[model samples]
Target: MTSARRTVHGTTIGIIVLDTAFERLPGDIAHAETWPFPVQFRVVRGVRPADVIEGDASLALAAFHEAIDDLVSLGARAITTSCGFLAAVQDELTRYSPVPFFASALLQIPLIERSLPAGRRVGLVVSDANALQERHFRNVGAEPGLPIAELPADGPIRANMRDNAQQVDRAAQERDALETVERLLAAHPDVGAIVLECANLPPYSDAIARRFGLPVYDIVTLVTWLHNALVPPRYRV
Candidate 1:
């Protein structure tokens, strides 16, 4: 609710969050500073990270819808979530939301794929490679066969998410993220662009892009696009 943000981006964006206890570093969607525009967050009650990744978020459909209602009531023009695994429920939640609902950064896959050169395709860096299912891509309108990678489970990035730790080891995170991107690129030479499916991965987006020399897209970009559509800047003609 900063006046500075209001002057630049008029409306508020709502973020549906999972119930967890992790330090959200700058650039993480849950971190308020990650957004240039103002945002409102609603934690879907009792919905944990496991529920999102393991359950595919289908079990919490009604809860997510309820959160959307609350946010819409609070003047939120668009809605998004803190977890990329929410892509599993993207189709249904989008249909149920009163306003625009961007459930996951994975939403960028289809567009990125189509935007890439003929021989290149979009590659994904996800939080849990094992948890990703075909339905996640299908629900977001992304075609199957796109390559994917995961943060090392033992690394600070994945460890913090798993333990919901408040302290972050940033250097370690960057290293792990960079290595993950290297693996993704090495495995898929035709990858023209990189899409981070996990909302937390934006913190390392710049590093990934710099190291891999590929355009990286995440929730931040997706939300910025929505923010622009909802409240375009005024230009003095």
Candidate 2:
């Protein structure tokens, strides 16, 4: 048991990804190139995109726990999921996790809000506005009524993501993303920072920040923070 505790080494972060067939771009969490450090990924096979997003994740709890145990044995010290909507299962999964677990980028909402000046609030850009509920926020300890924007599922970009298309139109995705941000800003001008609730949305983060000049947060930022904490940079002091 001792010798087999860790079959791998030097990898600190383990990612739990859903069964997705969609194209994962360079900034997407599931894309290995997205991370600067090494990470181990365990896909909870048979768990589909719509199942986790629109349906209850309770049915997949057993599979999730199994994945956690598997990753831990593989030398992963921290774990995170590829889906942002999985925040609904945050408490349950964190308790079951052997290591620190971050269920969603939405978890950063509270801390980001606290950092904001008065009258300003952190805005959210989620994959499906209609599917996100109050419980997802409560599970992650974020305010329930915060301003949120959604990339309309009816649009070609989000539809492909929801349906898990093997390929995606990058140009159309970018245009839709910027338009979504425009709508969000129009509705709530007091939005201080924007948080992307879709793991695949990170590719457009830089574009959002460049156009709106607001700080954007996503799975990449969350994972990087977790990795840095687990493996701090060495300094010759």
Best by lDDT: 2
Q: Which residue segments of model 2 deviate by more than 4 Å?
A: 1-4
Q: After superposition, how far is residue 3 of candidate 1 from its true place, in Å?
A: 22
Clash-forming residue pairs, model 2: none
The residue-level lDDT of candidate 2 at 3 comes to: 63
lDDT of each: 0.87, 0.91
lDDT of 1 by residue, 96-129 (tens): 9878899899888877777888999888888889
Quantify how close model 1 is to the true structure by its C-alpha RMSD in Å. 4.1
Per-residue CA lDDT of candidate 2, range 156-231, in tens?
A: 6678877788889987888888899999999999999999999888989999999999999999999999999999
